[model samples]
Target: MKVTLPDGTELQLEEGATGGDAALAIGEGLARAALAVSVNGELRDLARPLPDGAQLSIITGKSPEALELIRHDTAHVLAAAVMELWPGVKISIGPAIENGFYYDFDFPEDAEVSDADFERIETKMREHVKAKESFTRQDISVQEAIEKFKTENQDYKVELIEDLITNEGAETVSLYTNGPFTDLCRGPHATDTGKIKAFKLTSIAGAYWRGDAKRQMLTRIYGTAFLSKEDLAEHLHMIEEAKKRDHRRLGKQLDLFHFSEISPGSPFWHPNGMKIWNSLHELWTEQNARRGYNRVKTPILLDVDLWKISGHWDKYRDNMYFTDIEDRPMGIKPMNCPAHIQIYKSERRSYRDLPIRYSEDGLVHRHEPSGTLHGLMRVRHITQDDAHIFCTEEQIQDEVIQCLRFGFYIYEIFGFEPKLELSTRPEQRVGDDATWDRAEAALENALQAEGLEYELNPGDGAFYGPKIDLHMKDSLGRSWQLGTVQLDFSMPERFELAYTGDDNDEHRPVMIHRALFGSFERFIGILIEHYGGEFPLWLAPVQAKIIPVSDLFNDYADQVAQTLVDAGLRPDVDARTESVGKKIREAELSKAPVMLVVGAEERDAGTVSVRRRHNAGDDDAKLTIGELVDVLSAEVAERRRPDAG
Candidate 1:
C-alpha cells in the first residue's frame, strides 16, 4: 500500500498496516509522539487500519486536537478513580464539553460525595495516570453489550445501548477499556493515561438522567485539563477573573436589578438598571428611525390559533406560556414575527412601498427550564429588538446587506469586534428547497459583497428560514451572539401577504426577520460582564457621582449636580456625611465613571475636583463647573468608552 504525507511524500507499507506503522516508517520519535491520526481529513484512532493509498497526518501533543483528546482521557481516569474509591457506584455517561469534561454517576445514598471529595479523587486520578494504562477499544454487537451491562447491574449503560439500537439502528457499539474501567464510547482517546498530565475536578452538581426531570438525579462532576501545568494555571486564572465578572454579583453590587419569588424569571429593574435599559432601547429606536423604519406595537396575548397558523403550536407549544381568557385558549406570544406579519397585511402596498420596515421592542414569553435561567441572560420574559421587512424578491440581497451593516454599526458602538456566521436551513424548515436555495445564496452573496469572512453552521437556522448570525467578542475575549438577519419565504406565503408589482399584478412579498439586540435583558447582561459593571460613559446608569469632601460643602455638591443636570448629564450628590476617602471608595465600588469631589478650595474657585474610577494615587484634576459639564456632556454625546480619549 502507498501512503502519502501532506508534504507529498509517499511511502510503501503493509497492505493492512495501521497509522502507527506508517508513523514508525517515517521516524521512531514521530511514532512515539503520535496521539492520533488524521486519515483523509477525518480524525481517527491510532489503532485504526490505514487504507490503501491513504493520506495521513500524525497528530502530536502540540496539535490543537490533542487537548480535547487529553480531556477525554482525563475524564475516563476520573471515572476510574471514582469507582476505585466507592465500589458498587453506578456510572452513567461522561462527555467532553467546550473547556472541560464531566461524568455523571448515580451513587449510593451513603457515598457522601461533595466538593470535599475532589481532593481524594484527584489523588487517585494521579495514581491512575502514574500506572500508565493503555486504552483498548472493542466493537461488539448491541445484544452482547446489553448483556454485559446487565450482568454488572449497569442499568444506565443498558438503557443507552437499547436506545442506540432501537433509535439509531445500531448493530455494533464500541467499548473503551482503560484497565478495570470500561465505557461505551466511540473514542479516539490518548494512547495512555500518562498523557493526561494537568487536570482538576473543579465543581460538582446534580443533573437528571438524560435531562428528564422525572428520572433519577445523578451526581455530575465537572473538570478541566490541559497539556502543561502553566497552561492549566492560565486557564484557572481566567476562570477566577470570570468569577469576578459574573453579572449576578455585579448586578447586586452596582444596584442594577434583582429577581424575586413573585415573578421567578422577571427582572425588577431599579432606577439604575432602568437607566441602562432605556438608553439601549432608545438608541435602538433612534437607529431604526434613521433607517426609515416605522415603530409599531402589538398585543402580547394572542389567540392560540394564530400560533397554529404560524406553525409554532405543533412544534413549539411546549415552550410557550398558555392561558385562558374567558374560556378561550390564548398564549403569551413567544415571538414577534407572527404579529408583525399581521401588521404588514393590514395595509396595501405597491412596488413603490415594497421595502416597508417596521421595528418594535417586543416583549415575549417562553417557558425556559428553571435550572437554565441565569440572572438576566435567560428569563421567561424577553424584550426582543424585533423588526420585519416586506420586500420584493429582487431586493432580498440588498436588504440583507443593509441589515448586516446596521448590526455591525450597533456592535461597533459597544466596541465589540463582530464575527459573522451563515446558518443553513434545518431539517424541519418551512420553505421548499428552491426557495431555501435562493435565500441561502442571497445571504451568502451579501456577505461576499461586504467582503466579510464567515463560517457555515449547518442545521442551526430557525425552523422558518435561513439566517445570518452575528457574534461579537468582548474585552475578556468571550464571544456573544448579539444579532441575526433571517430571510423567510414561508411566513409571507402562510400569511398570504401580497403587493402590486411593476406590472400591476398581485405578487407575494418576501419577509426578513431581523433583531440587532436579541433581547434587551440578555444584552445588558453581556454588557455588564463585558465591561465588568463599569459601563461606558454613555451607557452608565449614574454617569457621575458628586461626593462632597465634607458636609460643609453639601450645598456646593448639590449645586454641582444641578449644573450637570442642566447640561443634560446624569449626576447625583453622594452626601453620606462620611469621610472623603470612604465616599470615594463607595463611589468606585458602584462603578461610577467619574467622581466630582467639591471642597473649600474647589467651591471658592467654582471648580470641582475630579477623580476617575480605577485611577488611584493620581492627583485630582480641578476644572471649573462649566468646564466639567462640557467634558462630561461631550463624553455622553460621543458615547466614549472609559478608556477612550
Candidate 2:
C-alpha cells in the first residue's frame, strides 16, 4: 500500500499498517515524537490502522491536536487520582475544554472534595506523569460497556452509555486505559502520561450531570495545563489581571451602580451612574438624528395578541416575562421589533415613505435563570439601543452596510476593534429557503463590500432571519457581544406590513432589526472593565474635578465648576475642609480624568493646575482658563473616538 505524507512524500508500506508503523517507516525521530495522526483530516490515535493508499499527517507534541491529546490524558489522570484517594467514588465523564480540562464525579455521601484536596490531587497527577504510563484504547459493544459500568456501580457512566446506545444508535463505545484506571471516552489521547508536564488544578464547583437543574449534582474539578512552566505562569498572571479588573468590584468602588434583593437581575443607577447613562443616551440621540432615524417611544407592556401576531409568542416565549393585566395576558417586552412593527403598521405608506428608520431606547424584561445572572453583564431588565429599518427588498444590502458602518463608528469611540460574526438561519426558522438564502447572501455581500472579515456561526440566528454579531475585545482579551443586525422577512409577512411600490402595488417591505449597544446595563459593565472605571473624558460621569486648595478658594472653585457646567461639561467642585494633597488623592482614586486645582495664586490669576488621572508620577501643569478649556475639549473629543486614526 502507498501512504502520502504532508510534504507529498509517498512511502510503500504493508496494507493495514498503523499510523505508528507509518511514522516508524518515515524516521525514528518522528516515530518517537508522534502523539497522534490525521488520516484524510480525521484525527485518530497512533494505534489506529491506516487504510490502503491513504494520506496521513503525523501530529507531534507541538501541534494543537497533540495539545488536546495531552489535556485529555491529564483529565484521565485527574479522575484516576480522585478515585485512588477515595475508593467507591464513581467517575462520570471528563472532557478537555478550551483552556483546560475538568472531570465530574459522584463521591460517597460522607466524602466531599474541597480546596484542601487540591494539593494531594496535584501530587498524584505529577506522580502519574512521572510514571509514564501508556494510554491504551479499547472498543467494546454497548451492552458490554453498560454491563461493565453497572457492575462497577458507576450509575452515571452506565446512564450515559445507555442514552448513547438508545439515541445515537451506537453499536460500540471506546474506553481509554492507563495502568489501573479506565474511563469511558471517545479519545485520541497522548501517547503516554509523561507528555503532561505543566498542569495545575485551579478550582472546584458543583455541576449538574447533564446541565439539567433537576438532574443529579456532581462535583466538577477544574484545572488548566500548558506545554511549559513559563506559559502556565503567564496564563495564571492573565487570570489575576482579569480578577483585578472585574466590573463588580470596580462598580462598587466607583459608586456607579448596584443590585439588591428586591430586584435580583436589575441594576439601580446612582447619580453618578445616571450621569453616564444620560451622556450615552444624548450621544446616541445625536448620532441617530444625523442618520435620519426618527426617535419614537412605545408602551413597555403590550397585550398578548400583539406578540402572537408578531410570532414572539411562538418562538421567544420562554425568555419573555408575562403578567396578568386585569385578567388579560400582557408581556413585558423582551424585544422592540414587534412593537416597532406595530408602529409601522399604524400608518399606510407609499414608496415615497419607504425605508423608514425608527429608533427607540426600549426597556425590556427577559426571564434569565438566576444562576446565569452576573453583576451587569447579564441581567433581567435592560434598555436596548433598538432600531428597526423598514425598506424594500432591494434596499437590504445598502441598509445592512449602513448599519455595519454605524456599529463600527460606535465601537471605535471606545478604542475597540470590533470582531464580526455572521449567524445563519436556525433549523426551526420561519422563512422559506429562497428568502433565507437571499437574506443571508445580502448580509454576506454587505460585509464583504465593507471589507470586514467575519466568522460563520451556523444555526445560531433568530427564527425570523440571519444576523451579524459584533463583539468588542476588552483590555484582558475577553470578547463581549454588544452589537447585532438581523434581517427579518418573517416579521413583515406576519404583520402584513406593506409599502406601495412605484407601480402603485402594495409589496411587503423587509425589516432589519439592529442595536449598536445591545443593552445599557451590559455595555456599561463592559466599559467599566474595559477602562477600569477610568472612563474617557466624554463618557466620564464627572469629566473634571475642581479641588479648592483651601477654604479661601471656595468661591473661585464654585465659579470654575459653573464655567465648566455652562460650557457643556459635567464638573464638580470639592469644597470639603481637607488638605489639597488629600483632595487630589481622592480625585485620583475616583478616576476623574482631569483635576483642576484652584489655589489663591491660581484664583487671582484666573488659572488652574491640571492633573491627569492616569498620570501617577507626573507633575501638574498650570494653564489659563481658556487654555485649560481648549485642552480639555480636545481630550473629551478624543475620548469619544481616540481610535479613529
Candidate 3:
C-alpha cells in the first residue's frame, strides 16, 4: 500500500504495516523520534495499523500536542505507582486538563493519601520511565472489558464501559498496557514512558464522581508535565507567584471582603472593599454616560413566563434559582437580558429611537456548584456591568464595533492586552439561517475592521446569539474570559419587540447584549491578582493612609484626611495610639497607593510628607497641603498606577 507523508514524501509499505513501520520506511531518525502518527489530521497510536493512501505526520515529544499526551501518560504511571504502594486503591478516570492532568480514586476507608504521598508516587513514576516501558494497545469486546474491570473491583471503570456501550453503542474498547499497569483509554500516547521527561504532582483535593453532588466523593490528584526541565521550572515558578497573589488570601490580609457559612459563594464586602467597588462603578457609569448610555433598574424576581419566552428556562434552568412567590412562579434572574427585554417592550418606540442603549450594575444569581466556587472569581452572586443595545438591522456592524472597542478600552485602561475570540452559530441555536449568517458575519467583520487577530471558536455561541469574547491576560500570562459582546436576533423576535420603521411598518429591533466587566466581583478578583494587590490610586480601596507621628499629631492627621476627602480623594487616618514606624508598617501592608506622614515639623509647616508605596530609595517629599493636593489629585484624576504615585 502507498502512504503520503506531511512533506509530500511517498512510501510503500506492507498491507499489515503500522505507523511504526511507515516511519522506519521513511528514515531511521524519523522513526526513532516519532511518538505517534497524525493520520489524516487525527492523532493515532503508533502501534495501530496505518490506512492506505492516507496522509501521515510524525508526532514527537516536542510537538504542540505533546503536553496532553505526556500528562495523560504520566497519569497512568501515577496510578501504577499508587496501586503498587497500597493495594485496593480503586482508580477512576484520569484525563489531561488545561495545564495538567488529574486522576480520581476511591481510597480504602481506613487509609488516606495526601500531599505527603506525592513524592513516593513521583519516584515510582520515574522508575517506570527509566524502564522505558513501551505501551501495548489491544481492543476488547465491550462485555469482556466490563468483566475485566469487574473482576478487578474497579467499579468506576465498569460503569464507564457500560455507559460507552449503552449510550454510545460502542462495541469494542481499547486498553493500553505499560509495564505491569493497564488502563481503558482511547490513547495516542508517547511510544515509551521515557518520553515524559519533566513532571510534578502539584496538589490533591476532593471531587465527587462524575461531578454529581449526589455521588460519592473521591480523591483527586493533579499534576503537570513538560518535555524539558527548563519549561517545568518556569511553570513551577509561575505557580509560586500565583499562590502569593491569590485574591482570597489578599482579600483577608488587606481587609477587603469575607465569606460566611451563612451564605456560600456570596461575598460580604467590607467598607474597604466597597470603596473599590464604588471606584469601578463610578468610572463605569461616568464613561458609559458619556457614550450616550441610559441607566435603568429592573426587578430582581420576575415571573417564570419571561424566562420561558427568552429560552432561559430551556437552556439555563439548571443554573437558575426558582421559587413560588404569592402563588406565582418566580425566578431570581440569572441574567438581565430577559428583564431588559421587558423594559424595551414597555412602550411603543420609533425608528428614530433605535440604537437605544440601556446600562445597569445589576445583581444576578446562578446556582454554581459549591465545588466550583472560588472567592469572587466564581461566585453565585454577581453584580454585572450589563448593557443592551437595541438597534436597527442596518446598525448591527456599527453597534458591534462600538461594544467591541468599549471592552478593549476598559482592558487597555487596566493595562491588559486582550485576546479576542469570535464564536459562531452553534448547532442547536435559535433563529433562522439568514439571521445567524448575518450575526456571525457582522462579528467577524467588526473584529477584522479593527485589524485585530482572533480565533474562530466554532459551535460555542450562546443559544440565542453569536458573540465575540474578550480575554484578558493577567500578570502571570494566564488568559481569562472576562467580557462579551453578543449579537442576538431571537429575543426581539420572541417577544415581538418592534419599532415603527421609516416606511411606517413594525419591524423587530436587533439586540446587542454586552458586558464589559462581566461580573464586577470577578473583575475585582482578576484586578486584585493582576495588580498584585498594589492597585493604582483610582482603584485602590485606600488611596492614601494618613499616619501621625504621635497622639499630638492625630488632630493634624484628621485635618489632612478631611482636606483629601473634600478634594474627592479617599484617605484614611491611622488614629491608633502606636509608634510612627508601626503605623507606617501597617499602612504599607494595607497596600494604600500613598502614605502621608504627619509629624511636629509637618504640623508646624501645615504640610505633609508624601511616600509612594511602589517607589523605592526615594526620600519622603515634604509638600504643603495645597501642593500635595495639586500633585495627588492630578495622578488620581488621570488614574495613574502606583509607580506614578
Best by lDDT: 1
- CA lDDT of every candidate: 0.90, 0.88, 0.89
Lowest summed lDDT window (length 10), candidate 3: 636-645
Between candidates 2 and 3, the lDDT winner:
3
- Order candidates by lDDT, high to low: 1, 3, 2
Candidate 3 residue 380 Cα shift, in angstroms, is: 3.1
Off by over 4 Å in 1: 4-10, 40-42, 62-64, 138-175, 179-185, 209-216, 324-329, 427-433
RMSD of 3: 2.9
Give the 10-residue window scoring lowest on summed lDDT in candidate 2: 636-645
What does candidate 1's lDDT look like per residue over 1-645, in tens digits?
Answer: 898998999989988888888889999999988888888988888888888988889998888888999898998998999999998899999988899999999998898899999999999999888898998889999999999999988899999999998899999999999978999998988778887779999999999999999999999999999988998998898888889999999999888899998988899999999999988977998899999789999999999999999888988999999999999999899999899989888889889997999899999999999878899999998999999999988899999999999998888788899999999989987778888888888999999999999999998887878899999998878888889898888888888999999899999899998998899999999999988898888899998899988889999999999988898788989889799889888899888889989999999999998988888889989999989988888888777766666
Provide TM-scores for the models.
0.92, 0.92, 0.91
CA RMSD of each candidate after superposition: 2.7, 2.8, 2.9
Pairs clashing in candidate 3?
none
Residue-pair clashes per candidate: 0, 0, 0
Candidate 1, residue 18: CA error in Å? 1.8
Model 2 root-mean-square deviation: 2.8
